[model samples]
Target: MNDVKAAVLYAKDDIRVEEMSVPSLEPHEILVKVKATGICGSDLPRVLGDAAHHYPLVLGHEFSGVVEKIGIGVSRVKVGDRVAGVPLKPCFKCHDCASGNFAQCKYYSFIGSRVNGSWAEYVAIPEINALPFDESISFEEAAFVEPSAVALHALQLIQFQGGEHVAILGGGNIGLLTLQWVKILGAREVTVFDIDDERLETARALGADHTINAKNANVDEDWKTITKGKGFAVVLETAGSDVTMRQSFDISANKAKVCFVGTPVRDLTFTPKQFEQLNRKEFTLTGSWMSYSAPFPGNEWELTLHFLKLGRLNFKALIDRTFPLDNINEAFDLYRKPGSVKGKIMMLND
Candidate 1:
């Protein structure tokens, strides 16, 4: 009920730790004592670039905590339950929401971006947004639910089937998570492409059959070698860069499924030949938005927790480092250095 330490972003490249009053609960909200929160790739633009929609906001979405208090009408979970926070708050009356496509709801409000969020000692969220998990999963691992659900949601978009050749066009956090999901879903062989050697190694350790350094290798020839010149049956572009976006087309097999899960910041153009790949091969091209489906946050969030408890998601390898709540600025500072962050950087409340 007193002031708590929270990281507030006043402007681009300006974030600081300050004492603020803990959020009060609404009739259906739950007060949570946040234990861990992860900095997402999308946060880079909001923190370092000019993507923030508002100034002086608390910006963290991927988080885990223990329920400290509950609203009068809340009954799904008790005060002592452990839970992962869901960021999407779609307007239930929207057309998309009525159709069970909550991610497409135009009037949706998101945590961290559109409102104050969990880069703090305490956060209050809707009771329905608190997805409880058992004690078998650690708090840090539970914090990964959002990103993991994102990866799964993208695959779910394509009705992803396994036992086929799959190529992931990035070895970053989302790419790494995507790689693991495909492997678990029964992909026969998986190849990860990236410029960083360390990330490639991590991908290999996480079940990638091959890791190609796009910077140093002849990517076109190397991918051909991996697939024996047949091309990938399924390709996921998670880098959001022009290079990888175009590569996703080139490496795809005829009539293959391709999904772009990354958000591109710049305008992308393809050449006549490059654009022809979609027409000639008849590739099924689609892009994935924020993770959500029927029944609110959907199976994506539920299955992520299920896998985490089963010890299959490998959250430990995806976390690069952890910092205390007071040093949240120091965590943002890492994003300024090129290629400095190899994985998720977490802020722990304790």
Candidate 2:
């Protein structure tokens, strides 16, 4: 391939579609013809808030495509295989990685940040990063594998078991996906909290036992009634906002497992009262980073595809809108306006 069309980010709020040379593959690499890519919430700051590591980058990680070619030493997948892209590239030699905690590796490179990514017609990825899926799953659905894996990783971090009350403190894409995974994994009751009524409705449709609009309702009182004053056995903080992060601690039951899956943008502080909840309740507080484990990108990626094939993991409603690759700038524009988009915004290439 001589020429490739891509969405190039030149500076903050400055992304354009341009033709660039296709990337060359090295050993253990695969060239995927890009099909569908979801615009992650993290990407907003990279393009609009100047959170990108460098300029003129192709910012995409949640993506799926067909393998156009494979470099030598690539045996897991062949040309024409449908695959999802794993963004994390951890140094296997790091202590964290050697211990099966790839997400904790400090020595690592990331696609879309440290290197070029898949907002283009094609992208060259490591063999282990391209996870092949069955023909039944659409490229759009496969694009959700990264976020789905993220949601699963958080649950796995706490070793969540079924038959306990679970509280999801966000109703965004990741929060909704986490809710679905909670229900699929047999949580006794799943409650989703969000400021948006529409997203709360979506969560209800996705099998959330209860939906709380924290904006209007008294969350402290509502959650008390929902949990029958027992509090949630497991609380997942997915909004990354100051309010929800603190709320996670407040809504937890004694010795509850609380996992922070959302990334916060601003400085966070907790009052002496709020901070004491951890000590008093004996909460197992943990933060989940990128998804990965022993055998590379780990079972989270595979399990996502398995559930997708079984129709247990829903990906359709999570998609709010789809934009053509040529109109990616328009897609980013939607993000500039607050509350303009609800779910995942996908960019598709024909």
Candidate 3:
């Protein structure tokens, strides 16, 4: 492969579009020509702050591509297949991976973090990580499979049968995606809380029963009334702020399932009230990491494709904007603005 164009992160706040060498394949690998990728909220901190596990990285894993080449013995997908991929490549010798809990593998590596990733013309991934989709799905929608699957996996951790009141504590991408899943899973009522009125409105259009602007409203009193003082049967905290992380426990019901899906901006600890909710209400809190499971790639990816194909999940509506890879700096500035409800800024290959 010749040198390919990429957005490379040389250091914190130092990303530039440059040509880099394309990756070589291993026996189990496939070289994908990246078609589309989405700049994740996590990408901001990692590229602008200190979240990169390593520097000079090509920082994007939420991408869709077409297979250009394959390595020896690779038969999961062939050349020209349109695909979305899981970013993880876990060392199977680890006890956790051997037991089917791939997410907890002792020696796990990631595309954007541990290795170069999809912010380029091409990326090499394991055949298992490259999931093929039919022509019915667009690369834009396929690029979203990773994030959508993340939201789906978080819901998978809960035990909601259906017809339960669930409150999503953030209206970001994950929050909104989880909101759709809650409604699809048959929640009697799904309320979304966010400081962004625009995101709340978006959530409303996407099927949330109600929206609360935490910046202006009293979440405690309103949440009680919203749930008829029964509290929410399930709560998802995707905001990642210190206050919202604490609020996830505060508004939970007795025996409710609470999932923290956001990457915390600071240390998350259980304070008096949060601890009291844990003690008094008997809350079950599940911390969801990158989505994956036994046979690799996980159920989330499978179900996301099914829902996307059936029109149950709308990937296009969640996209607020798009940019060519060259304008990544401008995209980053726009995304960091106060109250910006940028769903997901799609980065396109020129």
Q: Could you give candidate 1's per-residue lDDT for residues 167-202 as a string of tens digits?
A: 999999999999999999999999999999999999
Q: What TM-score, over all chains together, does every model reach?
A: 0.99, 0.98, 0.96
| Candidate 3 residue runs with Cα over 4 Å from true position | none
Per-residue accuracy of model 2 over 1-350 as CA lDDT, tens digit each: 57989899999888889999999999999999999998998998898887999988998998999999999999999998999999999999978888999888899899877789989999999999989888899999999999999999999989998889999999999999999998988999999999999999999999998989998757789999999998999999998998899889899999999999999988899999999999999989999987787788899999999999999989999999999999998887888789899999999998
- Model 3 lDDT per residue over 200-287, tens place: 8899999999888898757678888888888888988987887887888778899999888898888767767558878898889888
**Winner of 1 and 3 under TM-score:** 1
Of the two candidates 2 and 3, the one with more favorable TM-score, higher being better, is 2
Worst 10 residues of 1 by lDDT: 328-337
Q: How many pairs in model 3 have backbone atoms within 3 A of each other, for residues 3 or more apart or on separate chains, i.e. clashes?
A: 0
Pairs of colliding residues, candidate 2: none
Full-model lDDT for every candidate = 0.93, 0.92, 0.87
Question: Which parts of model 2 are misplaced by more than 4 Å?
Answer: none
If ranked by TM-score, best first, what sequence of candidates would result?
A: 1, 2, 3
